[model samples]
Target chain A: MPLSTVLTLHATTDTTLPNTMGHLAHAAFLALLDAAAPEVAEAVHGKGENKPFAVSPLTVHREPCPVGREGDTRGASRTAGRGRSVHGSRFTVHDRAVALAAGQECRLRISFLDDALFRPFSEAILTLGQPTIRLGKAELLIARVTCVGSDEEPEARYETYEQLVNRLPCTVDRAPCTAYREPCDADAHSVHGSRSTVHEQLSFRFTSPTAFRVRMAGGERVNWPLPDPVRCVRSWVRRWNEFSGFPFEEDELCAKVEGGVGLARHDLRTRMLEFPRGRELGFVGEVDWHLTKHALADEPFLRQLHTLARFAFYCGTGIKTAMGMGTTVCRAP
Target chain B: MPLSTVLTLHATTDTTLPNTMGHLAHAAFLALLDAAAPEVAEAVHGKGENKPFAVSPLTVHREPCPVGREGDTRGASRTAGRGRSVHGSRFTVHDRAVALAAGQECRLRISFLDDALFRPFSEAILTLGQPTIRLGKAELLIARVTCVGSDEEPEARYETYEQLVNRLPCTVDRAPCTAYREPCDADAHSVHGSRSTVHEQLSFRFTSPTAFRVRMAGGERVNWPLPDPVRCVRSWVRRWNEFSGFPFEEDELCAKVEGGVGLARHDLRTRMLEFPRGRELGFVGEVDWHLTKHALADEPFLRQLHTLARFAFYCGTGIKTAMGMGTTVCRAP
Candidate 1:
């Protein structure tokens, strides 16, 4: 059961919501999961084990922000206030009144690394229509479930990343999608080998502001201003190998990026991102980058590398993918 | 080995060429094949055998035609004369000098059912760049090869046509894509079995004018202006079974369409198509039809039927898929 599912929620009431809606959206996604498969949700977000899913930030579809900083800020707002009647979890937006209009829409997509959960999730989504949900001050009415699909199966081994990206849906912009790496503790045990023949180009468009989290020497978690490419790639590879039902170990292959052929970020700027839970101040920003000549040292791991890379496009990369962070669009070159 | 290849040819000449360019494209395509695999071409088109491929008519990208038909005709003219030097087969545009201008492009896509041939064909295409080739009076310099890929492997059984179509590339438009069958001879052997639970809706945009060739009572082949729904579905099913490397027959199944359900052609008109060999004055025309509830009698055949319908999209239906005919865009519902 090798599959990747994407669900498109078309908002009937407001689509012009602020980018910070990721928090509210993430709460609703969990509620939906709990409604569909409480056990599965418990297994994913419950108290001890690791999760097998990633949720993208709310991808808003609307006109560009108003001209000046003041004007743009006026068009989108966030406030802090508790819900009158809470179920499961309560999310509140403080004082911000600006939101998506009646006819506008936005998208909240989640990828299940575990294919076994697809059916329950799909069934739950199909039953959700016109659910009155509040993001902040605005109440949203979902018009329809526009699109839901599993990703195509991975292609033949030795296939280039440039050739694989075009086949995946929701990919935006052009090729050369890349993630930056500056070393991290999660991968403290990671070994960086020299390059191999997996020379391919990839492009990613950070549709929403994305952030990464890493632990400091004192065991305190902190957001990394710049994403660590090696850790990002490792997560995707590890998740895919475990849930794809065709498991492989990192120890079986040598994976590394050729030195000096570094990642190039383009046309991006940052925004201070806040969510409903108010646990931390996250960041969101637009990003476009290119990754070329990223190689896996072992010849036998070529197919596994390609499969994991392709999965990265759907499941996204970085921490809190399930909480609306790390949403990306990697186009095939 | 389940993959579909789409070749996007960026023309270094005018992009607004007429639909008739399919002739010149066919000539060049055969030449490319001859260069890559002469023996394969001979086996496909040579001797007396059914060709196992389909060639779509040249898909041109251009500014809309001029206001007056006469003005458009004046802008592009067709003059008849023999090729100064002929090779394999000669193709002439007949005094037509108004070809695609530089900086514009056209697409010539071909689908091969033989998975074994993908490698050699892919290699041959990658090596072609800036090849100065004459397509009658129009000389085209292929600026770049934009995209090339093989179709994804068929999804697991019990998959819906909707699911399968989305997994394959080259599908456009909305769902519930279908074809209308008004009744035809090829379907004479087609038993209109009573309906079962195999309900589905499909939409197909015949990018090229699609025609069907079926044998009459006397065993003579005739062209079908209107496609036979039963035969169309059957062909897709048969072809998919053969190429998917999974063999299954519907010996215990009966299939039928719901009453009053029919096909609707959108923005379509007919044209008398001619080829270089002058074997026959073939008719080709644009087709956009939606097929629904085209169900199979048995529940078990549902998966097989879905698989075949998806194959129809890549392999196409009817004859001469390899010579620029039967181009299609079948979208899932």
Candidate 2:
């Protein structure tokens, strides 16, 4: 199994600017990456003297611009004149570049540091009798910089500017900005400004491609068979309950068996197993046995057997868990 | 000058008994010593023993038996029958002890624990009329312990009865029992009956007093003035505020400066002053000057000074503050 890494991006701007904002936005994005993951920063920048790490596949999303007011031409004019507009965007780059595994979905939402700036603009547009874009929804276009004659906006500016604000190449949709009290929606493209404006960008790299492995032969997979440990434990406990005449509902059985296995495994992993190097080897076996044996054992004898099995599993999975286990296999090969 | 130690007690009991419940109200008294000088525990019950230390001068007060009550008839008949009763005699010890402190104008108050046993009793008493016991204007019985006595007749005979209460001696008014919620108001005494009545008394040697010196001549001798580095630092801060032209009223200034110097000195003594043998020495010097020179003169100069002084004050007071100072103090003197 591989350790999965999640990357989240939050963009905010006080003033409106066109594609020019992408340069600064990109810098901020890179800074966030460095702050969040210094090891990834080292890999991106490089280890040599004076050579900074390099970041790649820096995905950017442009959320819909909120609708502006009709009467308040001043706000629109200001945005038009400044040539910089805020199209709040969110970009996420998984640690691994591989496509998401089947049945695995990553849910993300927009997070804004300062919503005050966007509030005035939102209010200005709402007050005016104009098609105000929903605050958070990625649909309204306050300003667009494009090639001299693009299909979307015929009177454009630069050649590649038209290609910059295009839809992201991945499955994307609008998400609510719950952090903000106002009803603002977010889109993927809003994160990175027009691509033509960004000169230097950050990217990601896998230190080892085969660090995680998902093996189906041995029933080792990430999120396979729904991976509902509670269900598995409940089913096992229900079988025992029926035989023993113990009155218990599915939820109760699930809770008791799952909680018991979890608590026992946690105790064994934390208290019983001691690694001098401070490595978390014991947890791997504990988790494996807890999921496969302890949680699913019905017979009293089997329950005892499962405890020992969980202990052995802890020892076996120790190394893999420490290295990071996921569906994606990232190895030197 | 000695450090003025304020004793406050809070008690809770099941409310059912008549006004007679106050005698068993002992938690507030014990809590007073626990709050004022936790180190007193070591003094009374040798080092490492977990027994309460301080002894209160006030004898536990018990009200006269109410007329028409089952227990009252027995108590009143005995008092009239024998010219004196054992229960009444037992309470005489508390009255005599409290009389000494009362004569000295010491602050006193009864802290009644709000327990189920005391609820009905309190309600009935308050409904009928407030019980008043005046020991001079200076030393008034505040009626602190209003709890529930056993439902069994108060005069019920027992081969040997245990007094399930803990007591501490103090010179301050008890805190209102209602102010503290249940559970917290119940002390070990209320939870477990008095240890002395049930078990063979075990004797333990008390620790020797750790002498602390006070340079009274050099500085103003405020109430309970002692060389507490913490209070010293706090006083220095107040002096600084005054010098800085902050408008601090008399009560406010006194409250601020009262224990500040002692607290600062205490912290400096335990934390900053260290010897090669690992023995720590208390800081010596003017409160304002020492803190200003050593701890406060760091980054953000003035702010740092205020922070250190505030921290010392907080540590000494054992209260939470922005300075982040409250910490346990342990020293080998």
Candidate 3:
């Protein structure tokens, strides 16, 4: 089973911290596990590639303020005396650190990719030795923990690999027209009166900075920060195969996605993140995927695409997902 | 000189016609010239390779209506009783045709690439034989023709090649910070306190479907419908070189663009249009560009980039500008 958890916290004191807090969150999470389950903590800490869990950059539960003298004061607004929930969490990424005021509300989302880590992670969250956690120099008190989803955000979700596979709708209902056209896009199919039964159009919104580190022919490492449909789908499927233990035959599937999956629409922008060693650039935005008639007509592939799209909710997408680089979710336009 | 002219039209009768009218517009344009300037029309019709002029899809001066029974009646609302100009003219692309009622207002934008065609094109517009023009099956009266631009839309404009070259600002203004960081993006530059003297950023909004037909390694042609920075910049430069009559040395600049110019952001979508030959798929949307520290530092390359960016407004970004497929405008975000 896969499990996503959101830990809400209140700032204990006013302090400025790095805008990106994924690495710090990762460290604090380990510290939390050390207090409850040392063995699991040690295993997780020592785990190298394909770790069974991922963490998100800390997001304040308040609206973002413009950069100025009172920027820090504005960032640390408390949940008390406020009726409106923050619309969006767009922290100003600046050379200076972000300031969190005392009593400010915030959240840290964590997900376990493997079933083995689910119970342990849940237990660690319950039995945190300290009531407060440190992210950089700022200390925060654990205010709430949610494994449930809300209308706005799916704070938490749990699903088994088999459940994901078995729950797919087998057939897509065709529209009024039954004729088909071969050499055109989705829009053309509608125009040519090619009433498609495959009506699923998934738009993955990469909310966080998403990037891929690809090893070239000569083993040179190159960063691909843009949304390429093949790469995006491959990353999702690869994670599905790894955690779900699926012996998925994906060669043809990947090739089809590469050739047929056109980028239907996008509103993407490049962003930069700071790491211990250096900095990296990635893209953040929504990319709508357009499937070809063949891909849509193939029942198995269609189901597979849907499954992968839903799985992306928990699996993330590309490199550094554990440190909040590939936070992905499917959105309907 | 390049001239972009907008002709506002009023429908004489209510009629539902094909959603896309590029081919129809082309036919009607030639037909109009048959009465006004037959020689120039014959030359344009005979001219192969690069066309000196382009025609836009007819845009109704009214808000788009939903795909319901009343959609046609909604599309044809005349401007007679209203003081407001229509917003975005997103005519609903339906299986049927668009409905335009009596006295409905619309516009047709035409542009000329060659300086020699400017006067003849202007003369043709001035000496129209008929007061009414047909688009598809609908006949519309040429209510007004303007070469003067307003705030919302540059309805018409004229600029010479030398003027375009002379218009580029010599240098970019640096922000408050001054240290340099070569390894990060624009955000990172601001973060590392790299006060870049090169601060100019231009965004192009592809208001019409844009695409590239590339000849592959084996002479196979493929339609590239995504916004690839290299291809986008190269297309602009190629058109500039041809029409501006500049023997511009672009090898180094192109190499730098390929390696350094990054797609910063975009809100793009794929669209299909019917042509006389058949149909084609293209992308319509905005694509923001980011130049690397090295590219920004090179004054010549920077100026060249700015020149090409502005030139895109007139030259259009991709193939089929002559048929409104690459109708583009630069917008400030």
Taking every candidate in turn, the Cα RMSD to the unseen true structure, in Å, is: 27.4, 30.2, 9.2
lDDT of 1 by residue, A184-204 (tens): 112211111221123333334
| Tens-digit lDDT track of model 2 for A1-333 | 000112222222222223212123223333343544555544533522111111111223332223222122233333333321111232222221212211121111111111222233234434445221211212222232111333432211221211211312232222333211111223422433322111011111111111111232223221111112343334233323332233345575455443333110110011011122321111111111121222222333223222222111111111122222111110100
> Per-residue alpha-carbon lDDT of model 2 for B1-333, expressed as tens digits?
001111211111111221111222233333333344445422422422111111112222233322212122233223234321123333212111121212111212221111222233334334434333322222232333312223421211111101100111111122222210011121212212222111101111101111122222223111111233334334334333332233234344334322121111110111111112222112111111111111112223323233323222112222111111121111100
Off by over 4 Å in 1: A1-19, A47-50, A63-98, A127-137, A147-199, A251-255, A258-261, A264-269, A276-298, B1-333
Per-residue lDDT tens digits of candidate 1, residues B1-333?
Answer: 334444444444443444356667656766776667877666655623234555555443333332212122222222112211011122222112335445334445556666545555665666665454456655555543433332321111123234453342232222222223211112211111221122233445554545566443323344443343455665565665555556555332224321212333322322344555542222222222223332322333445444555566566766555555565544432
TM-score of chain A of each: 0.62, 0.17, 0.82
Per prediction, fnat is 0.00, 0.00, 0.15
Best by lDDT: 3
lDDT of 3 by residue, A1-333 (tens): 667888877777777678567778888887777777789889888876467888765666454422212234464444222312112543322223566777666777888888667676667666766467888898887777777768655657777777666555566653332121112133412311222244435567777778776543323344567778778878888777778876466787787666555554455655667778776667776666656555566778776776777677787888777777788876421
Candidates 1 and 2, the one with greater lDDT = 1
TM-score of chain B of each: 0.62, 0.19, 0.80
Candidate 2 chain A has its poorest 10 consecutive residues by lDDT at A263-272
Better of 1 and 3 by TM-score: 3
Predicted model with the maximum TM-score: 3
Ranking by lDDT: 3, 1, 2
As a whole number from 0 to 100, the lDDT of residue A182 in candidate 3 is 19
